[model samples]
Target: MTKTAEAGAAPARGARAVPRSVWALGFVSMFMDISSEMVHALLPIYMVAVLGTSVLAVGLIEGIAEATASIVKVFSGALSDRIGKRKLLAVVGYGLGALTKPVFPLAGALEWLVGARFVDRIGKGIRGAPRDALVADVTPPALRGAAYGLRQTLDTIGAFTGPLLAMGLMWWTANNYRLVFWLAVIPAFVAVAVLVFCVREPTLPAAARPPKLPLRRSELVRLGAPYWRVVGIGLVFTLARFSEAFLILRAEPAGLAPMWAPAVLVVMGLAYALSAYPAGVLSDRRPRLDVLLVGLALLVAADLVLAFAPGLVGLGVGVALWGLHMGFTQGLFNALIADSAPAELRGTAFGVFHLLTGLALLLASVIAGALWDAVGFQGTFVCGAVLAALTAAGLLVLRRKA
Candidate 1:
């Protein structure tokens, strides 16, 4: 079948259907990312300089947010399947998060800021997996790469713009964090509106899909024995992959100034944005495993560069490589999960995938931070390099067997 025909065809196994309206869902993500990155990029500054939150507290906060989001994802997806309304849930998630943005400006105490972050994360956890399932539902297996890449590209573009806008706002306002935060609310609201009016929910198979049995009892295991192996490989790869906070930390130690960190990120994001569409196209043409393995290798090289080399040049190379990997892997990940799993359980699968990766990232970041304190940057990269190398090897072995 042609790609378009394939997209409109029925899911192989009575999976709940996705509507064509689902395709434009990327706009929602795009707007959300813009709003999110704006706040996230500035949050450390606000917390440390303004609220005096310690590094440990920041880490704790991150862990809590990610773990909460990751764990809740499966439930929400399953619930959406049960309820037969991805649009409603998507609206709820986006709306709730947008509503929480004002809290940052309203927060006078450290506890209040934490509460705001928690609320925002709560919204994210609620909506994420269901959203992915919607994308999968509407598009066919062949189109999965394109759909996800389009979504990610939109999202990454937001990431790129949000920080730049925040910087401009800060410059305009003379670095008034409160004013900038309040302004963020505007975009958040716009995003909620887009999801509400613009995006349509995918159509589900008519018999009213049943709720997924909880974690241990999921029928998804029918995908087979080797399914678990892929999950394990994913987990190991995630362990080596830490937070991008490390990127900021690394760049500064190189010739990049601390204040210029966002600019560096912008550069990296631009690279990521440029490469994503082609990577997605590649995933569409070949096995997702190959594309994703290529991304891992690029990441490994980036880590190695971060460990050695001269000032600005080394930092640029590392950041660029990281961008390439991000481009390659993120979109390909969706393609892989889509290709490998039954459509009925897509949301649940993505939820599990994100949860594992998020948890791993949280742990890796903490460990890298501790390593930085004790063994310094060199030790940290050495460890990351080893993990990345192992990840690349594992991916290759998996491909060979395939």
Candidate 2:
């Protein structure tokens, strides 16, 4: 068979076996998540208690950090498409992230911390779209959902593990947040090493390579209606879900001690890790929109439970549901994007999707924080429930139209 034909051919065994490169990419994601989450699980409390920042400040920083990453993704993804290369950019991004790990522990002032976060998020933006596009390139079409899910699953494992480690170190060292942050540097470097030595980028078929400038109007227009529809749904979903930092904040008032606060992420991460792969596999078999609707319903339920239910029990249940919603939706969105966009424009599609959704998240988080400061956590969560419910209704309408 010709090279293009061979590149497009389906794997004989189907979704049962994915390429080794996909697994390597998954591990790369997992290790990086572990390193990042270790610091993140405790960063809010550190800013509040140690640095004396207000809740609104926390919201602004978190929102700005993520929005910065999303913005970078647009350019990095397009650049990857333009050059027909993904691995080099991925390496650069991951390397930047690894290099930034030490800054978290070294920062003594709030300004320093903010600077660190900004730089770190830029690295995330650089890698995010290219890495995702690379996954789509390497994996067979039939296994895209499974590949994304598996990557998410491993990433979530690191997400929880980081917090778990931080919690233990806190107890062992009498809440030494800096020490935990320092140790996190280890996994960040490990992630960079794994990506450098293990993951391999697949060559694109001749027909699937983009022109000189993938970001031009004509090229973007080729992304088509289906891709835009997925982007719309993704935007609404992001608006309904704000920063997870709020969950940690909520844990404090819900009766958890300061040192044990990371438990919130631990619970949430476990739920996410456990469900993501299964959800991915299921999405492969079922109508993806139907699966996504269920995820939206879970988000609504989580918000209500968080808003009204009392005590740690309520917090646990709500957080678990929130994690479940993440598991069900996050990978599926990527899978949907891959399914909708042309192979040549996949990186651009992911970049645009992330950029729009990240802006929505910034808006949502600011609103959530303002509500928390003015009324209380209950008001913030209740508003989230309403938005999630509305998004679900919108999805149903879209389904009907489809």
Candidate 3:
């Protein structure tokens, strides 16, 4: 069947039956996240404790790595639009990511770790927009929010599972970081294999294909104002939410040991995984802006808790709230972009969205690091709360105007 026909042919069961390809892609994301998270859950602590990097250095590395990926997404996303294909680039990206997994175990120096991180993020950048576009391509409009939410749910399952495993391995190996890194390599390759075998790209109709130069000024202008508004919201959101690395750091000062640090992510991931699908379904049934407002409220609460609640209990509460906010917001934002953008420009829209948000993240993370260094974690989170409040206020004004 043609891609369009297949996408529109929803099962008799309604939105409960997401497409098989979407499910497969979700699993693909899950496995890769499992691999990536296992490494990341340990990385912040590893950098600070073993590698002896400063808080500011960690922020710079994390910011730069993510920003690099976002920058690459622009070109990769445009190329997918230009060529009328997405799966090939996704394969290459996943493959490159899998290949880089070993470098983490082998690297003896901070520079080597940074280099591997840079390359891995490049792979992430390459695949992100195309994979997101592919999801939009296969799913019907009515189910888009649910589809993205389900994917986010599965991805978050991996996110927590990876940390759970890392925590276990750390206990098992007597805190052997290298061994954990080595074992993380397996799931990444499994993710690549699944993407290659299970997921199939939808064929775009000739009329639905983008222009020859999808990134050309004239072509981009066709994305229209609504899409740009969504992009603007995304930037503000990113600016308010900085790197999660700081979460791990927060636990350390609260009396968490190095081996148990991954537990922070485990708490957050559980909250995120559990809430994501429900939040997505809620958006589909209700107004997305309402759901997003709740998310912003959660962020404000989380920041306040993180800033003043005191001790590990407070840290746990704040982190879980942070995860809940993520569950509510992340997939919904993607749905908003899909809802607003032209069908042919979906990939480019996601690319630009990621690029601008990523730049915001870089600035946010840097500022967060500086604040953490200059004043304390209290200042860092308080700033986040203030930003979230401001963003929420802005959104309320816009909603009233609308």
Best by TM-score: 3
Error of 3 at 256 (Å): 1.0
> Tens-digit lDDT track for model 1 on 174-269?
888888888888888888888888876656674435455624455666544555666677789877767665676676578664345666667677
Question: Which runs in model 2 stand beyond 4 Å of their true positions?
Answer: 1-16, 205-207
TM-score of each: 0.90, 0.97, 0.98
Residue 59 CA error for candidate 3 (Å)? Answer: 0.5
Q: What TM-score number comes out for model 3?
A: 0.98
- Top-scoring candidate (lDDT): 3
**Considering only N, C-alpha and C atoms within 3 Å, which residue pairs clash in candidate 1?**
17-203, 17-204, 18-202, 18-203, 19-202, 19-203
Q: Write the per-residue lDDT of candidate 3 for residues 165-241, one digit (tens) a residue.
A: 99999999999999999999999999999999999787887787775778889888999988888888888988898
- Residue pairs of candidate 3 with colliding backbone atoms: none
The candidate 3 region of ten consecutive residues with least summed lDDT is 8-17
- Rank by TM-score, highest first: 3, 2, 1
- Per-residue alpha-carbon lDDT of candidate 2 for residues 212-275, written as tens digits (9 for 90 to 100): 5888999989999999999989998898989999999999779999889999999999999998
Q: Model 2, 378: alpha-carbon shift in Å? A: 0.6
Q: Relative to the unseen true structure, what is the C-alpha lDDT of residue 314 in candidate 3, on a scale of 0 to 100?
A: 98
